[model samples]
Target: MDYYLLPIIAIVLGFLFLILAFYLALSNARRITKLGFINLILIAVVAIACGLLLMFVFTGDLANFV
Candidate 1:
């Protein structure tokens, strides 16, 4: 019900942002210099951190799930 909506929405948005970041990284890889690859990794790390933080805030039981 209503309780599930926030978590569901957060998950969907998290995935969308991750996908967008990955696609942007791929696109940049083709156009930018070799150093740009580092940016891609940074972006991925940040996305993962954000996703985990969101899950932690919403679920409050990260250890049990992961």
Candidate 2:
């Protein structure tokens, strides 16, 4: 359990970042500049990548138990 803590925290943070990116995108929908768009895309990409990577790692670890 303790060994999984880091990946869990990372997954949670990745979701949080995704939510934050969504909120920011919606809130700034009317006047998003190029820089803002790029930032939003970067945040989304990082969040998705982090979430997916950790999920794969978690699943792979679980597979070893079965």
Candidate 3:
């Protein structure tokens, strides 16, 4: 029931999703280009969201993970 756990989970899930997106983009398919483009957007959004969550967790009072 730690306060920081939620953000940490979010960050991990984002990374996993990113990996899946990459796999999709790299797979041999007719729409590889479209998948790659979508993956790019997914990467950007996940990165930004995780980064902001980390910053908020550490900079804000929720950093009290102890």
Candidate 4:
């Protein structure tokens, strides 16, 4: 359970970021910079998720596989 904590925390944080980004995008629909902000957040979530997954996968922990 302890071994999974980091990735789980990361995923939860990523979801929060997604929700915030969506709200921002929705609230700024008339702005020309809307898409760029949303895209940046989306990219950030993907990158963070990937990095966390990789870290867990490469740890060689057979009992707690990602």
Candidate 5:
């Protein structure tokens, strides 16, 4: 395994999750609950934070991919 792989993977996967969450947020479903939206927001936030932290640990250079 490489030092860059884990954070890279986390960032890519996190982006995908973020996209999905945004899609869900954009969709209008009459029966959808507020809790579901909250969960999605949380997931997106945490995934993004986790990825960024990992990147920071591995690269120590923010705003650029590790």
Candidate 6:
């Protein structure tokens, strides 16, 4: 139970941070230069993709544990 809790918490926190970062980027888009904004967008996309991949890879193991 404790082990499961930690991973669940981590997943929630990761999603929270992702959403916060995205909102921050969007809010600052007008102030930042176009190039910088585009870079930020790209980074966000890559990060999301990597996160999803990780989740998929781990889900099998996690399911067995649960």
Q: Work out the TM-score per prediction.
A: 0.45, 0.49, 0.54, 0.52, 0.66, 0.48
* TM-score of predicted structure 5: 0.66
Q: lDDT of candidate 2 vs native?
A: 0.67
For all candidates in order, the CA lDDT equals 0.60, 0.67, 0.69, 0.68, 0.73, 0.59
Tens-digit lDDT track of model 2 for 1-66: 564565566666767766766776678776666677677667766766776676677678754653
lDDT of 5 by residue, 1-66 (tens): 886787777777777877776777678664446787777677777877887888787778654652
Per-residue lDDT tens digits for candidate 6, residues 1-66, read: 644355455555556655655776679766667666556566656665655655655575655554
lDDT score of residue 46 within candidate 6:
62
| Of 3 and 5, the candidate ranking higher by TM-score | 5
Best by lDDT: 5
Tens digit of per-residue lDDT, candidate 4, span 1-66: 575566666677777777777776778776537677767597768857865775667575843653
RMSD of each: 5.8, 4.3, 4.5, 4.7, 4.7, 5.1
**Of the pair 3 and 6, which is ahead by lDDT?**
3
Lowest summed lDDT over 10 consecutive residues: which window, candidate 1? 3-12
Better of 2 and 4 by lDDT: 4
List the candidate 2 regions with Cα displacement exceeding 4 Å. Answer: 30-66
Where does model 1 exceed 4 Å of error?
A: 1-32, 61-66
TM-score-wise, the better of 2 and 4 is: 4
